[model samples]
Target: MICKVAILLVVASVVLASPYNPYYQQQPYAFKYGVQDSYSGQNFGRKEISDGNVVKGTYSVDLPDGRQQTVDYQADKYSGFQAKVSYTGQYH
Candidate 1:
């Protein structure tokens, strides 16, 4: 099981080289992070926000027979990314 999520952006690249550049402005960010471990049984968490157009996030994990998996996500560079999944305990 490999789960890693990273979103970091920093670019100017000579004023973005004119794909309708118009002086290159798009920057907004918010962040949250979490982790929990009960002696090698790891838990997970995430939170996010952005205003470079639109972004939202939620993440969770704690599943290994006893369920606890959740994800809620949103994106808007004209509707490019989306996710919605959910689960909760007691499913042997």
Candidate 2:
């Protein structure tokens, strides 16, 4: 009887200590790439896609004064790199 009780306690403890949580869902792979510094209020990120001679990517930065900037760029053996940036208001 004591042995059975000890085994039951061990099993219960193992079940309760599991790392899996049902409430949290994993994010998609594309959203996972980025370096963010919450303490400094800054973030930087880039992602790329390529085919043959052409390569394209997106870059983003978060400023310390509550503004964000993003750029979409592309480059090729023939056309060089070109980007367009979008930002909100002036820097404070």
Candidate 3:
């Protein structure tokens, strides 16, 4: 009986923690990401939103010269892709 109870608990935990489990659901239109490594001293982050036809997003990356560049973009079936990029911080 004790062994059976342990097995049941393990199964229950696995089901609850599974990414594909029906009880666990993720937002269809929401995402977040970040990256950092030796190539750049600072980290970069991006956020995005999208449906079937339209996509909009923004990203910020730190440059090697101590500046930060931020870009905002949008793309859709009608207008295509467009982006606006800006920079900030001190550069040697």
Which 10 successive residues of model 3 have the least lDDT summed?
19-28
Candidate 1 lDDT, tens digit per residue, 59-79?
A: 998888889998999998688
Query: How well does candidate 1 match the true structure in TM-score terms?
Result: 0.41
- Indicate whether candidate 2 or candidate 3 has the larger TM-score: 3
Clashes, model 2: 0
Please identify model 1 stretches exceeding 4 Å from their true place: 1-27, 39-42, 63-65, 75-83, 87-90
> TM per model?
0.41, 0.55, 0.60
Kindly report which residue stretches of model 3 are placed more than 4 angstroms away from their true locations once superposed. Answer: 1-28, 36-40
lDDT by residue (tens digit), candidate 2, 1-92: 99999999999999889876687554323322788777866688889777545777898888766678889988865789999998875788
CA lDDT scores, all candidates in order: 0.81, 0.77, 0.86
Query: Clash totals for all models, in order?
Result: 0, 0, 0
Say what the RMSD of model 1 is: 17.3
Global local distance difference test of model 2? 0.77
Residue 35 of model 1 has an lDDT of 89
In what order do the candidates fall by TM-score, top score first?
3, 2, 1
